[model samples]
Target: NVEATKTVVDLISEQMEKGFEIPSDKVITVESSGSSDNVAIINCCFGHRVNETMGRVVALLLSARKGRNIGIEIDPYRIKLTPASSKEVLEVIKSLRPEAVPELAERALLDTKLLQWKIIHSARKFGYLSKDLDLSRINLRKLVIKLKDTPIYREAVREIFVEKMDVEKASELISQFGKSIKIKVYDSLSPIGLASREHAFDLLMPGKPVEALLRIFRQRLEKEVTVFHCLNCKYTVKTPIRLIGDLRCPRCHSGLIACFNARRKLEEIPKKELHRIANLVLSHGKKAVLAMNTHGVGAENAARILSKYYENDDKFYLELMEAERRYIRTRGFWD
Candidate 1:
């Protein structure tokens, strides 16, 4: 086992050195198993430290660029309360972020069959039995909690939940329901009412209810999230910007006018025409009308604005010519 573990670790390290891009589908799946029919005894057989050491070694093995395909197999008992293994699992669990623990546990429990069995056996070791005395029937969200600071309970829960539930979803649910679990301080005359509140607190937090609600909400939201597309480029942008202005397109400078406030689709117009109109508007300033008594742009302002976007338009070119002639005539001295 030591040689095998070392070999796996070396392979992973070598692959990682080459810029960690393992073909997950092509890599070998490795695991640990024992010769025993009593799965619980088999799982519990490994000491906690040994399990911790193995988990660390296996984790290193999987760290190779192509090592994601490397799988760890332990019998149903080894992953639980056994001294070496349980401590190791807890160490790993502690290393993970709090938000990540629940979902990671759920995934391990649900997706990996042997891992799930190990979790169940560990739960039995900790006395977290269902009403029916079956681990399978127990509320997973409840079972996978800190039965207040004991490593045995902590490891058992973290591994189970992360293996079975979606971490993000679980986190959202836990936040939403956490307040309900708090005991309310009511000034009730009846001692029985206060006793009931204490009883409720002792019964446990609303973790399972939160999980159920999250599952329902997830199902409802799955169908409602739709992709929005950009009309001009025919690209599917997850959330497209709505056309608010009679603005020019940033990409092609096409006129973009919104058809309706409720929709993102817009109408496009030619860039040349838009520039021509803008130039014409800017040219018809205040001072030009008083001087020429003609519907033409002011000499000074038109020259400043029109020189940039319209170098070749007939109307703008004519305006520029007129401005030059006016300048020459107004100058008392000739050049």
Candidate 2:
């Protein structure tokens, strides 16, 4: 029996050796899972991103091992004990048991730290979390805008801000809030420190030299949606979180901090204000930062933005799972 398992493991190892990029450091071994007779597990599990890849690997093992392709009849061939999936993951979520996230992490066969962060971060995006889940130390500076009056166009701008970009929603927003709203971006351009004061350009003030403003905006916000100042050096840069390690200041390598949230900056604003912002950008001969609709005023590559931030480091996935469990017990399932 042990030899049969070993043979299966060897065939898998051989297949992995051929073309797979599975790490050499990973120990391919069999162990008792307590619930099953024998199990072959990847001790260094990569998580949910590897779902399809694992499916392919298993399919290859079944087809190539034991001399010929063997078909095992079953309702569904489940992959268990992988970071991305397992028997417990499917059963736990599918049954709507309201299991705490850590429990879910165990069921999913993922490291608790990495899993907790991923789930919490994802949940927070849509305002689902009961409290702020700010485990990540990524920082940025941002400008916040609030609509003057609740215009009919408020819905449209809100939709754009969130990057949902629904045509019908936009149209509905246009009809409801379209031309009636007025928007005002804040007036914090007065630089507090000497450096900002020296180059202190008033971006919020309407009808300033459009060309200079356009150049300044371009310089500050390119790959980054917005710009923020460094806490220590006061150097301005907007960097992605994944590349946070590379975000050291050119001068002092000090920390960067954001005053406001770049994404979803304006929670609720009037439609006319959204229109004004678009027109203001167009008048300046600059592309509207939030592009959408026929004129492309609020359009965005929504998936690209989400993909950048939703990345997870598997080793530290659910670092807060225990905290989450305790929180849930104190309050209720929604927590």
Candidate 3:
């Protein structure tokens, strides 16, 4: 079973690298019995650094290995992932299936041009209109209210609304006020051009800084997407195909997923049966992969970490899976 899984993962990776098409015959499905605690426990210190889609795949495999079935879940906003051991479990599953689809976060950030301009315009209105309004003690909400009532706010704002202030600081202020006033600030703004020179601080980097790097990558090329599903609620979501960071689901909060690789597919086994799946992807720095979207280094990072273990050799994926099983059994982490 381990070897077969590995073969699938490696094959998938190779096909992706070669820009080859995925063969339907090669697709394999693994199901969970929906049991909790069947998933392994992992340290959450670096959880934020992990991928969401990758996390789900690890959780699913963990559940399957333990012979316990538990679906994963996600949150409403689809930002952060929930559940523990999501990273480790997903990695195991990703090692088995490498042809999954891309995630929403993976999609390129919407053009923030209009968003930035509007924010700056709003801020200028508040700052200039209030220049004589004695805004020192006025909280942000009251300031916005005054701006709406006074045309002086509009004239004052229109004068100083430079495109340069549209980046982070301007956006941050606008977003803060946007939330307070329930106004759609971004809808009125336009994006400024980036500084042609790396040293040019004149033009600002676009979009939210948190996902900036991922956004840049999405603009440049195509990448693979990792899909995540919850064992408890059966909620499903995909990871950004371009980002190498997270791979967990955003709903129902489950981390189980079937990740695709060129070799074997890593599946999540329950805590009681973690002995079967732990060591397959563990190494000096390899955080245990989970099927949940919220934990670990995430699918992209996990793939880089466990890439050494992936191979089309008949026994490679199986060997790692068995090694994980042995480690889990011997470690006695599960009761």
Candidate 4:
């Protein structure tokens, strides 16, 4: 196991030394399951330290480049986040700025929706009107919030729907108002709420490798949750953006969701390159596993071997549905 881990680590280090591009391998797939499963571990944190899972993703990138098949497995239970109650987080809304809340969520590896609800609370504090959990129905009336009885913004009361705004555009608009009143506008846009979430893996479940791997799982598995509209009925529902999935509105059950992938949300920020580096670290660990893999699976099959274990995406759910049908045994309740 130690020798196997060392070989993959050397391969990864060579790639890292090559500056993100692993030395091109002529082999399309190298299938070898001779090594022990325990060889799947590695010592890497990067210049800044990375979790074991994060290292697997880094190894995956290398796997793709090297054509060296590796078995990457993931455990769904390791990455679960405890949901906080709405009221509990509402108390912290005032102390945190609209932009800073997502940072809090990101640091904790919490869902972006967690920050979404908090933004709504802060918006309400600034006297903006909202009627949705996601704050998709927010409206800012000019006179709703005033400092010393002065209108927050002399501009006509309007809806700066966050779905239609970007971070820079939102920031520019918010700056029209004074610093004291900036957050009100910021609240409306929910810039961080609408943007993509980038997980901070190393900090979560410190010293645990799977926690690190889950971070990479998040990046690869994360989907853009978008609002879809039914043009025929004028009804909308939020759903995932998928190339091979249906987007039907639950309300009408008659029309397909027309807005999948149509607009970028308020909180969608691009993953930093450092995060990619973190993923490389994750991939390396997986490579280590492959170096010692005893599974006897074919080469091409080795890629995404972890998919069955990591739960996310419609594919996993579909598999679950199939399992339930095949194994449930009874048709009715209380069998």
Which candidate tops TM-score? 2
Residue 34 of model 1, lDDT score:
25
Worst 10 residues of 1 by lDDT: 33-42
Whole-model Cα lDDT of every candidate shown, in order: 0.32, 0.29, 0.31, 0.29
Best by lDDT: 1
What is the C-alpha lDDT profile of model 3 across 1-335, one tens digit per residue? 55545544664576456443332212211211122233222211111112223233343455556555433321111111112233334344334433321221111111222222232345555455322333323354444444443554444333323321112222222233223322111111011100111112112233234245434333432243444334445554454434534433455433343333212222321222222122333332112332212123234333443556545432332333334333322221110
lDDT for model 4 comes to 0.29
The per-prediction tally of clashing pairs is 36, 29, 134, 32
**Candidate closer to the true structure by lDDT (higher is better), 3 or 4:** 3
Model 2: runs farther than 4 Å from truth? 1-106, 109-111, 129-229, 233-335
Each candidate structure's TM-score, on Cα atoms with residue i matched to residue i, is 0.16, 0.19, 0.16, 0.18
Judge candidate 2 against the unseen true structure and give its global Cα lDDT, from 0 to 1: 0.29
Choose 1 or 4, whichever is better by lDDT. Answer: 1
The full ranking of all candidates by lDDT, starting with the best, is 1, 3, 4, 2
